[model samples]
Target: MSVDKLDMQSPDLVYQNIEKLAESFPNCVTESDTGKAIDFDLLRQELSHAVVEGNKERYRLEWPGKKEAIVTANLPTTKTLRPLLKESVDFDNTENIYIEGDNLEVLKLLQESYLGKIKMIYIDPPYNTGKDFVYKDNFAKDTQEELFESGQKDEYNQRLIVNPETSGRYHSNWLNMMYPRLKLARNLLSANGIVVISIDEKEVHNLRKLCDEIYGEKNFAGEIIWKNSSKNDQDYISTQHEYLVCYVKDKSINKGNWIEKKEGLDEIYKAFDSFKKKHGEDWEAIHQEALAWYKQFSESNPIFSSKHYSWLDEKGVYFPDNISGPNHGQYVYDVIHPITKEVCKAPSSGWRYPESTLKQRIKEKLVHFGKDHSTVPNNKTYLKNTEFQSLTSIRYKDGRVASKNLAKLFGENLFTNPKDPDLLCELFKSFELKENDIILDFFSGSGTTAEAVMKLNFETDSICRFILVQLPEDLNETLRTASGGAKATITRSIQYLKKFNKPTTIAELGKQRIKLCSANYTKKNKPTIGFRVYRLDDSNMQNVHYKPQEYAQANLDLFSDNVKSDRTADDLLAQVMLAWGLPLSLKIERLEITGKEVFRVAQNSLYACFDKGLDETFAKEIAKDKPLRVVFRDNGFKDDTAKVNVKQLLKQLSPETEMKVI
Candidate 1:
């Protein structure tokens, strides 16, 4: 068989949708001049029992660029991610990924490999505050219009456009930018995955409506009102809170409540363990010592709030709770005190649990009583049993904590308003992630989510991974337009980047933050602490590789090969892995097989050799191990006969292996 050629482009979403429709409603799908497409009239008829009409007014979100936004989400991108070895901390083994690119294109490129793979997605997108910059997607801009507008934008490639209030389509522009990115993000989420978006009051209403439509109103999980700051700057009312809007991919699949251990519970447990070690089974002495220890903390402290849980037993630290029912006349029963061997004084309301349960608790030493029979028996609520609590709708965290921590890490205030990693850690823990589960943050500003994931893994001894994507927004250009404190902050950031000989961009700053976090980590038993850095750029292939027919036959000889002149074999391998639906984290090993350099990926899963002079001898040598898939450079073969013979040799030796060329 003729060798198959790699597409070297992101998966075509429109075609995938058509195939999905065909599977569900075969009669509604038909072949068109362009390709397989859904017959709209037939599809409408299939959904309704009556005759379908056209152009009905429905309650839906509408904007000037809604159609264009839909088109943008469906459009395939030819952009590919090029791995940067120098920037990466641990390129070979780390499962964590850090990507610098326009997140829209990055999301499109990740569609196939990470489809339904990510467990959580947290993004702090631009809140459409009029001053913030939003991405100007190239597909939405006409060629002539783009040329005209290029001069109006900044010198940083004109990829970002400031969305000021003076713009005519202010809300429309923000919605257009967000819609396509959110649409693409939804595809990466697993069936039970959830996405949390941070927004302020500036665009929260519009954001809620947009997410309600995209994630389905039924899957709209509750929102968190984070009282992070006490801002008196607002004239009307002091807006002190921001929102974390959460939505599940499929509500039906996401069962159970999101629960997390209460803050300071770990410290309380540690203290209790120490008390037990010192006092042994002396319950009264442990309780007295614990109460004395708790007295040192203020009432505002979370640990101090748990002071009532000082009483100890073999079951662990506990507090006495009233066993009385709501009313004054329910479930009254006789209970004899163990020490006095006499009937104990019953509660006025009667027991909370039934008589049989109360008896079992007394027998199991879970019921606490007074020294004499005069006092009512109480229920023992163990601190260990009540460690986890349901996530609250409102949370209080000082926003400056994150900024201060980041400043200390860099020894300068390099970023503006970084999110709190501790807060993100608590939020992620509510989901109870498994080992290797991915947490993706497309708008990874300051890399707080990366820090949070690493800290979570280290503390819990779990191996969850993170994928962070941030645009390389130039800080030098930003400093030019910035004013007051913002300008000073940017100047400091530029100096910091210069100190490290790094680029003056937001992506670089984020990378440094991650590196600092890795360096500062003191734990010897690290849990996937580093990340592999990849940057989105033009594909490794030349124009002729994608559209050879566009070039004249006479000029074909001038091209040496389909691959780009400056691209390396490693770049080609990355694109090939992405095109083949393999994750970028797969282990790669370089080997020399009979003189030709070959890449052995994930053991015997895939093998690729981009070097020239391929022949039957090399093919026979590689085919011995029998990789599931193999790729070779098209022009690398010695001759047509040599290429044909290699294919035949592989077929005879490893019948199951599929051979392709790029």
Candidate 2:
């Protein structure tokens, strides 16, 4: 299809049309006096019976004999008694990090302390290729399974399922997986920060819409096209460009400009010799060549003179108007040259100083005249008077190639892709970097951001710290064949430091090993002192054994490659919550008093901790506490239990609390 036709064929527009159509259809039931649909009066009547007398306002009615009960529990009064061990890996002393695990969990763990503090975030998430390990979506609450099996159709409907291409909800599945994560990421960006998502064309459109919704459409920045590959083998044509969608938290608050300084005029003078050597020193030709070369150099360097005019009277080539405005109201008249003895007319405007300053100019012998005594005189301004060059976006061929040269210095493809440290260094130069400015990059990748910041600090003698996050995904096979696998990526990155000749050792990198740190809330009553490790769950076990050794040996064949038997899901979840800053003293109780066994947590407020079977009676008891927060395990709830009524129970008891399932 032509580009114009493709531009008009947007999936988003089509989706909007479908949504409008759906909304226009009317309900098949009658309307109530409140103008709301009245199809659920029977269910409401049943729910009314669940209320406990005076607490009727706090309870929600579910069904006739299946009425749920409501009660209020006191919040936990326990206090934190001990200091927590620092779980965070300290990379402040270095510029690298290699984390091993799921990025989603890591991101959640960082939300508490790092919220709205990250300066830059770069993510190369799985592209959702059918073969890629897509995160399994878990939306069903713990009670769902129970309700389903109890001859209840609604509860069975909430079972967690993998999204398949033929499901007709392919895009919806991807969107659901990404929505919460992106929302969390937006909260972690600094007000003046930006996030860059690297994506292929397949999901670029979806990513853009997702980012617009989370980061605000007004904060949308332009997309940057990166040439990721030289060869492409597709059904139709080669696709070589990947997009880097940039979004700022608040565009108005972020004031960023290209970091480049103009080249000094002296460099232009030095270049004259090279130009003469290339294109012989024919005065006019040499001047032309030099001027052309300087123009290109100045465009990038921002230091070369814009106007190349020599002093009118043999004062030499210099930029016009070097002087500033008159200091006082006194009008400084132009001085007469000592040699020409004529009133020297300042370039167009007049001398920078008033007439009184003319005496100083003559005394300093700073005035000059034209070859003809009668012609208008001029001032002598040497080329040495050049200060720092101005800033500009124009890039010179030389500067543009510096990054490539730097990349080559570290070895061929040593790093999959490395950014120009100079680019970041230049950025630092433009800002007033305080000694304590903490820079962060969750997508640390090859650690280029750290290296760039280090280089800037070295040059300016400023002390700045950096936080880098990089998931240790196994290196691609291509990378392994070329430079060995995981070890090579790390080795090449650390070795690049030799370019600066600083005392960086492989041992130092190892010593400064990055540890997985969960958010503060990942812990339980007593926070996990060490890293809370986790592995994906699998169900291939041949048999269950109580002993660790027996389980490992007998079930070896049944264990999936990524499965873990050392820790339970609850153990890992607790650790993750502790690291995420969840407070201790939160109550946890397993109750068998409802339709399905349920776990209840009550402290300052109640939280349903039902990660397993949720009994109706247990849920009723949980509702009694008037929980302020509740989360359920996707596979815990029964098939026969009513899922909709679970929501109704919460609404009747504690209307202001939040309820979510994982």
lDDT of 2 by residue, 484-521 (tens): 34357545645554564522432223112222112211
Model 2 quality (TM-score) = 0.43
lDDT against the true structure, per candidate, is 0.83, 0.47
**RMSD, one per candidate, in order:** 12.4, 19.5
Which candidate wins on lDDT? 1
The TM-score obtained by model 1 is 0.82
* lDDT per residue (tens digit) for residues 268-295 in model 1: 6788789999988887788788887766
Top-TM-score structure, candidate number: 1
Q: Report lDDT (Cα) of residue 105, candidate 1.
A: 86
lDDT of 1 at 619: 90
